[model samples]
Target: MTDVLLGIDQNVDRAVTQAETMLDLFDATDLDANLLHDFVDNPEGASVKQVDSVKRARDILEDAGAAVTLREGSGDPAQSILDMAEQLDVDLICIAGRKRSPAGKALFGSVSQSVILNAERPVLTCGSPGDEA
Candidate 1:
């Protein structure tokens, strides 16, 4: 069965919104929420960290009927998501994207940009929830 792995990032609110939105995009297909824990725990450097909000987000997704998958990773966010995609042979990746201007993004490239650029398989990027104005 073709699996749609929703590559989750640290942003809890975003991840929850993404998962809820993805529920529509992946109706018949099997969907799994692969939450990137180490990324949340160690964004800048390797120091054991814990955040309750992230754990709560994972539980929220699970309660929403999302099959959750957790794993540790150390690298760029784009690389982490891509590695899982390749390893699982995922058909598509559902990620979050911000509606940033070219100049704004040039100053800081978002994870969505990196994933879309390097992913071997097709990527589906959902816009930020806050930008629905």
Candidate 2:
């Protein structure tokens, strides 16, 4: 099975939805998918809502036949994503990218941009309508 890794950010549900949609689109083909939801889950600094959401995302992905795993990082979402891709030796990666303004890009380096620039495999990016900047 060709492994497709969905690199989920702090907001994981959206990534899962997009990846599933892609899977459904290619339903006729043979492909295997999994989701890796990463975050900084410091025992003293994490929010209950965040933890629960990540867990729920994992459960949903697993139910959909993709292995789901939650990994802890030091708040570097991009690094966490790359680490997971390397560990899995994934053939493809799907990540959520919001439309960013020039200002936004200057202020906060775009994670999607970083991934697209660094990924060894193909990276699929989805953006919100308003985020189309």
Candidate 3:
């Protein structure tokens, strides 16, 4: 019974796309909580968006026969992802990557980069469709 932590941000469509490509990796999944962490200051709006995002991912994964339980968290995206993965002790971490220019990444550090650098477990990253990798 492998536990997979599917890390997602506000890009619900991109997350769905990544899930479609990686769900087969986890043999047996009974997601206790579909963790949705908001990395924004405004709690109210962020919570609403987080719920919607989690529900979308939940629906997509559930349709594919994955049992999902929705959960919520707060703070930095990368930190939240790492914290959840560690607390849950997940077997694998799947995260969706957005194509950002080097300048942009320098200006605003990459979340995936942070997780990949700091995570103790394996991190699988999927870029958006048509992305140059």
Q: TM per model? A: 0.73, 0.71, 0.82
- Model 3 misplaced stretches (Cα beyond 4 Å): 28-33, 45-50, 131-133
Clashing pairs in 2: 99-131
Q: What is candidate 1's lDDT per residue for 1-133, written digit by digit as tens? A: 4466666655666666666666666653355766554363454564312444346546766676767666656667778888878888877887877678888888877778898999999898776557521
In Å, residue 86's CA in model 1 sits off its true spot by 0.3
Residues 55-96 of candidate 3 have per-residue lDDT tens digits of 677777777777665545566878888888898888778788
Best model number under TM-score = 3
Better of 1 and 2 by lDDT: 1
TM-score-sorted candidate list, best first? 3, 1, 2
Q: If ranked by lDDT, best first, what sequence of candidates would result?
A: 3, 1, 2
Residue-level lDDT tens digits of model 2 in 31-96: 565555555556576642365445655565566566444555556677777777888898877788
> After superposition on all CA atoms, how large is the RMSD of candidate 2?
3.7
The TM-score, computed over Cα atoms with residue i paired to residue i, of candidate 1 is: 0.73
Error of 3 at 40 (Å): 2.3
Provide the lowest-lDDT 10-residue window in model 1.
46-55
- Give candidate 2's whole-model lDDT: 0.64
